[model samples]
Target chain A: MEITDIGGVLCNGIKEGKYGLGLVRVRGSIAGVFTQNKIRAAPVIVCEENIRDGVVEGVIVNSGNANAYTGEQGMRDAREMCRIAANLLGCEERRVAVASTGVIGRKLDMEWIRKKAPEVYSGLGNSVENAERFGRAIVTTDRFVKKAYSEKARIAAVAKGAGMIAPNMATMLCFAFTSAKFDSGELYDMLRRAADKTFNRLTVDGDTSTNDTVLLISTGKERVERDVFEEELCSVFYSIAKQMARDGEGATKVFEVRVDGARNDEDANLIARAVASSLLVKTAIFGCDPNWGRIIAAAGYSGADVDERITLSLSDGRDEVFLIDSGRPLGNEERARVLMEKAEELVIRLRLEKGNGKGFAIGCDLTYDYVKLNAEYTT
Target chain B: MEITDIGGVLCNGIKEGKYGLGLVRVRGSIAGVFTQNKIRAAPVIVCEENIRDGVVEGVIVNSGNANAYTGEQGMRDAREMCRIAANLLGCEERRVAVASTGVIGRKLDMEWIRKKAPEVYSGLGNSVENAERFGRAIVTTDRFVKKAYSEKARIAAVAKGAGMIAPNMATMLCFAFTSAKFDSGELYDMLRRAADKTFNRLTVDGDTSTNDTVLLISTGKERVERDVFEEELCSVFYSIAKQMARDGEGATKVFEVRVDGARNDEDANLIARAVASSLLVKTAIFGCDPNWGRIIAAAGYSGADVDERITLSLSDGRDEVFLIDSGRPLGNEERARVLMEKAEELVIRLRLEKGNGKGFAIGCDLTYDYVKLNAEYTT
Candidate 1:
C-alpha cells in the first residue's frame, strides 16, 4: 500500500506562517478516534457523524482556528468544508473527514478555504515534499514537522501538536495510510490498541484539547500478516508519540516513566501516568536534581495500590543508578546526578514488588521556555 | 483564644538561612489534618498517632529536612522531637505534636534540633514579633509570612508554604489557636469543614506533598457561640489560603474560579478545580490574555456534566465582563483585558444551566519564576 497524494496550502487568508490547510487524497476503509473532551470542535463532531460507515476518501484539516464552541454556524462551516472537499475529489461528502486545530471558539475562514481547496487538491502527490508540507501546515506551536514511515508494513504516519497535551488523545492531529488489506473493524481494534500504548500514554502539560483526532486509512494495495501489520503500526505510532514528546513546547529533553510489577494493568498505567503528568517531577528532572521523592510522592497520590516496598532507578539508556532499593534509600545522588546530566532522554524506572503488570508513559521536562511560549500563545 | 507562646530559631546549625525550627506552646484540646499522600512523613505519622486522643500541649516543627522516607530512624526522630518539646513544656510526650518540611528522603538533624530546641522554648512568648518569627522559620521558598486573625471569635493562624501545593492539604504547615471553648470532636469537625472549603480548594502546581499538616488548638479561655466560632475559623482559613496562593513561587496574581449551577456539589468542585489547575489557563492569565477558550476547555474536561449553555464572566471584584452568555460568544475581549490587567485577584465565574450546585477554587498563575524556583528547589 502507498499514499496516493498529499498537499498543503495557506488557507487562513495568510500568505505565510501559523495558519494553513492540508489535504490527503486516498481511498480506503478508515478507522478514527476523536477527543473525549465534552466540548468537541465542529470538525470533530462532523467527522464523527460522517465516519459511521467506516469509509473515507480523504481528510481536510486546518490550523489557526479550532472552530469550537462556535454554535450552529460552526457546525455548518464544518459540513461546508467536507462538502467542498467532496466536490473537489468527486466523492460523497460523508466520505470526506475534516479536522481543525488552533484557537478555540472561532469560526473557520470558509471563503479562504473555498479559494485554496482547489489549489491544495491540484498539488496533491505522493512525495516526501508533499508529506513534509502537510506536516508543517497542521502545526500551530510545534517546532518541527513529525513524520514516520514503516517500510516493512508500508505504513506512513504524520502528527502535529505541541501543547495542551494529555492522555485520551492530546491536542493533536494524526493521519496514517497503509496498503495492507484490513476491514474497518480490524483497523479500529488495532488502532485503538496501538494508540492506548502510545498517544494515550503521553502528557505534555496535562491539558486535553477539544479538537484531537487520529485517523487510520488502509488503501488495501498489499496484504501482510496480521501480527506483522500490527507490530509495524505500533512502531510507527511509537515513533510519532516520542517525537511529539521531544518537541513539546519549550521542551529540552524527553522524559519517560516505566512502571512494573503492579497488581493490574490499570494500576500500572495509573502510576506511570501520574509520574509523567507531575509538574514537580518534570521540574526536578529539568534541574537534573535526581529528586526521587517527587516521583514517589506522585505515585502515592495516583489513586493506585502502592506501598513502601517499591524500587526506583534512574537511567540514561546506557547506565542505571538505583535511588531506592525496595523502600530503602540508596543515597546514590552522585551517580544519579551524573546520569541525569548526561542523558538526552531521561528514564525513570519504578519496580513495585506487587504483581506482574507493567506500563509506561512519555513526557517532557518543565522549563522557563514552556512558560514563555504558553504565556504568549494567544496574546 | 490567645497565642500563649511562639518562637522560631535556626536549627540546621546555621546562624541564618533557609533552615530553622519553630515552636508553639499551649495546653488544651487539639484537632489536626495531615496530608492524604500515601507516603506520609515520619512527623505526619507520629502526629496522627498522638492526636488520636485529642489532647495536645504544644507543637515542635523544623524546616531543614522533611524527615520522610527515612524508615524506622525517621519515626524515632519525630518522637524524639515531641519528647523534647514535651519535656521543655512540662507536658506528656503524647500530648506534643511534631512536623517537618523541606527536602525529602533525608534524615532529621536531631543533634541540631536537640541543641536549638531549648533556644526556641526559652524565647517562646505571645507577641506579634514571635508570631512573625514562627512564620518566617517555617518557610522554604515563600517570599512573605502568611498570618490571619479573627477579632470577634478570637482566632489566630499562621501558614508557611510556597511550592508542592495542591488539594487535601498543600505542602503547607498551618497552626491556628482559638480561645473559644470547644470539645476535640467539635473542633475536628469544624477544622475539617473549614479546611475543605479553604486549604483544600487551593492549587499552585498540583503537587501534593507528603508532609502537609494543619493543627487547630483551643486554649478554652473564652466561651463563644458555635456558629460564630465556625465562621471565624473559616474566615481565617480563607485569608491564609489566599495568602498562600498569592505567595506561590513566582506568582504575580491570584486566580480564582467559581462554578455555579452544576449538576451537584462534586461536579461544581471538579469544574472549579479543573479550571484553577489548568497550566494553560494559568499561563494565559500570566500573559493577561483574555482566552476564555482555555477556561471553557478546562471545564469541559473536568469530568463534569457541562454543556454549551453555560455562562462565563471575568471580574476583578469590581466590574464584570461577560465573555460567553447562554452558549453564545459576546466578544468582550477589550473589557475583559482591562479587568485582567488591573486586577490583582482575577475571578472567573461560570454559570451552568444544569443545577444549583456551586463551588470555587484558588490558584496562582504559571510564570517563569515558578519554573525557576521549583527547578532549582533542592539543587
Candidate 2:
C-alpha cells in the first residue's frame, strides 16, 4: 500500500543504506499536534515550528532508531532530514518537518538514508493499496492499518499507533496526508481541535510514550475553501484517531466515558481519565462485569471537585443503564444485567452537581491479551 | 486464625444496630503513622490526635459506611467512637483513636454502633483467637485471612485489604496489635517509618482509595527494646503488606521490584512503580517470557530521569538470576529455564545510572484468574 493513492498525498520509503530507513510523506498544507512532554523529541520541535509558521509542505519520518536523548546530534539529524526532503521537493526545509520513532539514544543511520533518498523520491503513486501499505510501514507494533477517507472532500488519512495511549495524549506515531486544498492556518487549528477531541481523549494503558507525533498534510489538489476543506480533513482525521484508539493492542471494546456538570472541564477530564485509566475498571469492562461500584469509586477519587449527589449512568452500548447516586447503587438486577449483556462497547455518563464543566474520554478494555503483548515484548 | 494469636492485642467489634459497625483494637504502646491525604476522614483525625498525645490505648474502626465527606457529623461519630472506647478502658478519649472504611457519603451508622457497643465490649479479649476474629470482622472483600507474626519480638499483625491498593493508598484497612511495650511516641514514629518502607511500597491496582488506614497497637505484655521491636515490627508489617499485594484480586505471584542508583529515593520509587504496575510487564512475568524490552520500555516512559545504559537482573526466588542491559537479554538457557520452571514469587532488580535513588515496590503477576475475578465481580 502507498499513501499517494489517498488522493493528494505522496510517500516514499528509503533504505538509507547506512542510517537505517527513511520515509517522506508530503502534502502542501498541513495541520498537526505535538506531544506535551516537557522533554520532547525532534519531530515535535519541527512540527511546532511549521505550524507556527502558518505553512507546511510535508513530513519526513524515519524508523529503526529514535533520535532522542542524544544531545545535539539528535537535533542535527532532525534538521538534516528536513533539509534533504526540502531539497528534493523544491521547498524550504522549515516547511518540511521531520519525525522519528524507534529505540532511544541511538544516532540516525544517516549514511543509509543518504544513499537511498533518490530511489525513494522517484517512486510515488496514488492508490488505496498504496495508502494502506504506507500505513502499515509507519507502524511499530500496530496490528492493523488505520486509514479513513471522506469522499466529499477527496481527503484521506492514515495513522500508525498500536500502544502507549493515555488520557492526555496518545503515545503514537502518525502521518496523515490529504489532497484537499486548505489554508495552512485553518489546517493547524482544525488539527489541534480534532486532536484535543480525539487523540488526546484516549487511554490505552496510561503509559505515555516519549516519542509520540501526529502530522497532517494537505496536497492542495482539490483547492477547496479553507473552512470546507478543514471540516472534511478533521472528520477524516477524527475517524483515523478513533480507529487507533479502538485498535489498541489487546483492546476488545472501545469505551467512551462522558463526564458532565463538573466544576470545570479540567475536573471533568480528570474524572473521566480516572475511570478510563483504572485497570480494575477496564478489566471489569472486559469481563462484562457491570461493576458500577468500581466506576463510581474511580470517579470519586479522581481528585475532581464533585458532589456526592452527582448522578451517574453506565451502559454497555445500549438503552439499558445503571444508576448510582448519594453513594448507593440503584436499579434492579434485570436492568443491570440487560445493560451488562447489551453491547460490546460501553458508555459511562456522569453529571456532577458542582458546575457545568463537561468532558469525554475514550478507552479500551484491559484483558489478559494486553498483558501477553506487553509482558513478553522483549522475550 | 485471629489477629490476637499473632501476639498481644485486645479487640472489640461494636454494631450499633442501625447505621454502622464499630471496632476497637488496642496495643499497649506501638508506633503509628498518619495518612498523606489532606482531606482525611474523621477516624484519621482521631488517630492523629491520639498519636500526638503520645498514647494509643485503643482504635475504633467502623464499616457499613465511611464517616467521610460528612463534615461535622462525621467528626461527631469519630469522637463518639473514641469516647465510648476511652470510657470503657479508663483512659482519656484523646488516647483512643478511630478508623472507618466502606461506602462514601452516608453518615456513620451511629445508632447501630451505639446499640451493639455493649455486646462488642463484652467480646473483647486478650487471646490470639480474639485478635483473629478482629481481623475477620474488619474485612470487606478479602478472600483469605491475612495475619503475620515474627517470633523474634513476639510481634504479630493482621490486615484486610484485597483491592484499591496503590503507592499513595487504598481502601486498605489494617490493624496490628503487639505485646512488645514501647512508649506511645516511639511506637508512633517507628510504625510510621516502617509503614513508609513496607505497606507504602506495595500496590495492588494503582487506585488510591479515599478511606485507607493502618494502625499499630501494643499490649505491653512483652517488654522489647525500641530498636528490636522496630526491626521485628517493620519486618512483620512488610511481610503482611507483601502478602496483601500478592493476594490482590486475581493476582498470581508477588513481585518485589528493587530499583537502585537513581537521582533520589522518589525517583527510584517512580521507576519501580512504573515497572511493577505495568500490565504488560506483569503479564510477561506471568508467562515467564523474560521480556526485558517491556521492562526497559516501561522504565523509559516512567516519567523519571533514567539512563538507558543501566543493568537489569531478574531473580525468581531461587538460585537463578538473569541479567539484561542496553536493550538486550544476556542470560543463559539454564537461567531462562529456571525463571519459567516455577510459579513462585519473583524479584526484579533494575539499576539506573542516574544518582543514588533506591526504591522498592511490590506487585503481582497478571493472569487469567484476575480477568475472571474482575469480570465476574459485578455480574
lDDT of 2 at B369: 69
Per-residue lDDT of candidate 1, residues B1-379 (tens digit)? 2243312211111224767888877777889988877788999999989988988887888886899878899999999999998998898999988889887788888898899888888887666567667777787777776788888888878778775233322378888888788989999999999988898888422345888899998878788899999999999999988999998778899978999999998899989988888778888899888898888888888889988888999999888999999899888988898888889998999999899999999988889988897789763
Number of clashes recorded per candidate:
2, 40
lDDT of 2 by residue, B1-379 (tens): 3555544356755333223343555646644554443345677776776777555766777765667656678778889988887787777888777777765556676776776666777788866556655665666656765778777687666676775233332367777766677667777688878887887777422245656777777777767777888888788888788778777776777788899988898888888887887766777677776755556656766768875556788777665565656433464535664675584788889887778889988887777767666666553
**Candidate 1 vs. truth: CA RMSD?**
3.1
**Candidate 2: true interface contacts recovered:** 0.35
Find the 10 residues in a row with the least total lDDT in model 1 chain A.
Answer: A6-15
With a 3 Å backbone cut-off (N, CA, C), the pairs that clash in candidate 1 are: A1-A179, B1-B179
Candidate with top DockQ is 1
